[model samples]
Target: MTYELTRDRVEHYFDRTATKVWERLTSDAPVSRIRETVRKGRAQMRDKLLSALPADLNGVRVLDAGCGAGQMTHELAMRGADVVAVDISPSLVKIAADRLPNTLKPRVTFASGDMLSADHGAFDHVIAMDSLIYYTEDDIRRALDNLGARTSGSVAFTVAPRTPLLMGMWYAGKAFPKSDRSPTMIPHGPSRLRKTVSDIGQLNDLGRVNSGFYISQALEFRP
Candidate 1:
């Protein structure tokens, strides 16, 4: 199920798909309204990070790793924290800047680059919402280690339940079917997800919800 990893092909597929998702999730319309659709979802995302957040993060630097469109990144800043928003795609970074409120823009530092490579070590918190799904188990292990290195207190990330069928679709979606290149890969079930998370390190499973079969949201953190 390997598809050509051409830059144009990869970027084109993600740019369109991400835009569609962004519209659906952020729209003010009735049916597509994310806030209405997922009651308490925002609190849930906030809670995951809050559970392990140190008591002294008011002025701490935060890294919004893989901050697509800056939705969650904005939320981080709204909480009175300094945020360094980052994404692999230039287009997403641009959109994030545009989406930000003019007043809050000063608090956000948007950078376009790989989260694993970015010098985010100065930050106190590192958040990977709906990210960290792209790598294989080995890759995920390495990424977690890297993220932990840069994090001052804890590292928070979300992973999807991965299965054989889902894994195939994930790869195809990346190369052929052209799905969003996020929530890249994860365990297909809750048990496997828990095991994977725990095996890497002591992680508190924040809980799980139906966030689309291809990308279920289950927050895990090492504190």
Candidate 2:
């Protein structure tokens, strides 16, 4: 099973609750100190993943899975990769398209739907950012397997790393009444993820990025 229920929740949360907040956060707009830290952390993580790819991507096909607002998609296209940027939220996808530079339009395809859709065609590389942080291990493993089968090169992604501060937040967030809660982030350790998706590829840790409330660990999986 593809775990449709979890994905539905993810899709709904991003489309409804997070669309506007994320648009502002990903842009140059000023946000709260905590969110500002998150912005910085995300920028660092984005650069880290990009560094793993070949410097020149002429003729490369890249999938910007869960490409919120298209920042990663923009960068990949600028590197000469034909990028398929897919996100679950149509609203965010539109924002991504709107923000995309006209010169880069020919290099990108912005779509809103399942990022792992086989219909997107095979890819040279895949960048998933923080998109996989909400799913279970089973869901993540299945996603990596699906991507591994379709991708010829490395898959770079992020997870909410298991740490003391985040673990506390995880527990505290759960205390809220069900209706008030957004999609909860599932924290995974780098070591655990290595074992969880071991069958798909050779996984390498790219260290952790922690800026205040934003704590994510980047990993590169080469199939």
Give the per-residue lDDT of model 1 (tens digit) for 121-200.
56677888765655455556667767766776667777655656666876676685335344345454545544665655
lDDT of 2 by residue, 40-103 (tens): 9999999999999998998999999999989999999999999999999999999999999999
Could you tell me the TM-score of candidate 2?
0.96
Provide the lowest-lDDT 10-residue window in model 1. Answer: 1-10
Candidate 2 local lDDT, residue 53: 95
Clash count of each predicted structure = 8, 0
The lDDT of model 2 is 0.90
TM-scores vs. true structure, each candidate: 0.72, 0.96
Residue-level lDDT for 89 in candidate 2: 94
Residue pairs with colliding backbones in model 1 are 133-184, 133-185, 161-187, 161-188, 162-186, 162-187, 162-188, 163-188
Which stretches of candidate 2 lie above 4 Å from their native place? none
* Segments of candidate 1 deviating more than 4 angstroms: 1-12, 29-47, 50-56, 162-184, 188-200, 211-215
Local distance difference test, each candidate: 0.63, 0.90
